[model samples]
Target: MSFLQRLTTGLTASKIGTDRFGNTYYESRKSWLGYGRKRRFVLYAGEPDPTTVPPEWHCWLHHVTDAPLSEQKRYPWQREHQRNLTGTAQAYRPPGHDYAGARRAPTAGDYEAWTPGG
Candidate 1:
């Protein structure tokens, strides 16, 4: 962080909570410019990846909730939070994707192509 950021955060930010990933959330101690709500922010434990934030904390960070939820209750069918892997090796690739095989089974001959005049 820059010197300016350190100073501002030190002067204005107050610790709100920490997430399971060790990220620390904060909100401003006072209203910003005395006109709007206090600012909210996070200090990432490691690399600053937004997707690392869990849903409950995300809601609090965005001011959707006044406080972080006490716990993240998961339903039996719910999957856990996962970091985005869009450009990484572990990202999802369908069977016909170029990185997979680039080939899909031929479609069943059930439909005919529509011509411009037909």
Candidate 2:
């Protein structure tokens, strides 16, 4: 097997759960080198970005909820989790949108008559 695959193989975890977007989470059978002694870390099979983690899993990952989403009760007012991609090209740029293709407004006191040599 490949070196990367061999390294990951050490962390053996059964198929604990998966998200709608096909992000599978594994519960590490081994303990991480930390104070907790029995700490767990998640592995994203697809996009390995933290923003891709859903709210339900986010809470569990942070130890907010002891039970997984499959065994938990969701409230009606609960909103779907969305990754914040502000300041990026995906973000919306209202009407003016900086200075591109926009004309500057005329100022009230506009007088430009300066002779360098005179």
Candidate 3:
């Protein structure tokens, strides 16, 4: 965090929890920027990426959970979180895409071109 962001936020907050991703969560009842209600904040372990937050921790971060992520049980169906990669090389590219691979990788069987259905 920059010196200015630390000075402006999360200084007075109480440590609530830390996720497996190393992001530390906090809560502050103190008035920040003149807000009265409690506030939530995260001290990111690395660059601040919201998608890195898993489903369990996300709930607590948004006041949707009474308990932290550690207290929750993750079902087997839940997949790991993935950060957004819209512009990166790892981003999704369809076969017909112009920026990447061959345009429309041959989707065909026996095809017939009709001339007025004669």
Candidate 4:
């Protein structure tokens, strides 16, 4: 963190839960505003990419789930949550992708072409 951010947020050493792919979140026991009251704040150690968080962790972070993954059980049919990166270059390209390998058929002569002089 920069000197200005540290000074403005008044953050002290925090308890780290996990660190993955340069993303680390910490819980502070000190108030961010330094008003003598402590509030839990999750800070992204690196870039603030929402995809960095897994589904279970995302639910916990948003308070949607009361229990963490460690305390929870997964159903047999439940599939793991995967980040949606569609519309990007990394998206899935099926066999008939028009830009990749699909060929366009020649135009049919259903209607005569219009000619100004004819």
- Backbone clashes in model 2, listed as residue pairs: none
Task: Rank candidates by TM-score, best first.
Answer: 1, 3, 2, 4
- Model-by-model lDDT, in order? 0.85, 0.64, 0.77, 0.56
lDDT of 4 by residue, 1-118 (tens): 6788666445454544553444444445555575544443355556555676755466666556544355247699986545566887778877658755784444686567899999
Q: Kindly provide the TM-score of model 2 when superposed on the true structure, using C-alpha atoms.
A: 0.55
| Steric clash pairs (candidate 1) | none
What's the distance in Å from true for residue 41, model 1? 0.7
Task: Give the total clashing residue pairs for model 3.
Answer: 0
Per-residue lDDT of 1-118 in model 2, one digit per residue for the tens?
3578547755565446777656766666766666563444566655566787777787777777765666346599976656666867667655555723454555799677899987
Q: Which segments of candidate 2 are over 4 A away from where they belong? A: 1-3, 6-11, 71-84, 99-118
Misplaced by over 4 Å in model 4 are 1-16, 27-47, 71-87, 104-118
What 10-residue stretch in candidate 2 is worst by lDDT?
95-104
Candidate 1 vs candidate 4, TM-score winner: 1
**Candidate 3 residue-wise lDDT, 20-105, digit = tens:** 88988888857567765678878898998888787777887787877665645769997766889999989998877877765675
The digit string of per-residue lDDT tens for model 1 on 37-88 reads 9889998888899988888889998889998987767799998778899999
